[model samples]
Target: MREDLTEQLSPAQIIERAEMSKAFRDVFALAGGKRVLFWMLEQCAIYTDAYTGENNSTNYALGLQSAGRKLIAKLDEIDPQFYPELLLAMKEIREADKAAAKSLAEKLEPEDDADIA
Candidate 1:
């Protein structure tokens, strides 16, 4: 019964794996949600003072940066025009995120007038 169960599940598992693989390939090939991908990579690649011989970033962050770089290279190979798209996307997202963060901070902070009393 165990052997039969394994046999029955193998084909379904194989198909599921193939479908997931194709789905991921299509996502990258079509550049769908690539802005989100760039955002994630940008977060991973943040090294602030790492370049200044400071151990500011944790080992986990450094590892993420290394892996993110390899993924970036693969993305570049997949789309020769990726760099320009990445540049534009990064700039737009950064500005939007910065504005959103500032707005949220303003809403969350106590009023200066209230504190002055």
Candidate 2:
């Protein structure tokens, strides 16, 4: 049974299924491994400073994000799995939202007498 299950599941299929999962989809959809790790690090600093009563300044925030991006770049060079989906998701989400909004507006107003301003 174990052998049959192993034979049935290719590693790529397993990875894709895991990536498409509701919880993990956001992770894979965001960026690749190193970037994902860097985001986790940033979130940790935010929460940790909040708990420790450290003053969070604009400079500090900028520094943190800069560090994150730098780390992501370095990690990508070293490990080569950095996939950024933020821009792609931005386009997709905006298109989806536009379609939904258009549908709603049409439902609210008839085409012949609608004020399209």
Candidate number with greatest lDDT: 1
lDDT, candidates in the order shown? 0.66, 0.54
Per-residue lDDT tens digits of candidate 1, residues 3-102?
A: 5654777787868855755654566444436676666677766434235355554566687778777767766644656656767766777788799999
User: Model 1's lDDT to the true fold?
Assistant: 0.66
Instruction: For residues 24-88, write the lDDT of model 2, one tens digit per residue.
Output: 43454453532455456556353243332455665576566666566556444433543244335
Cα RMSD (angstroms) for every candidate in the order listed: 10.3, 11.7
Can you give the TM-score per candidate against the true fold?
0.45, 0.34
CA shift at 26, candidate 2, in angstroms? 7.2
Note the residue pairs that clash in candidate 2: none
In candidate 1, clashing pairs total 0
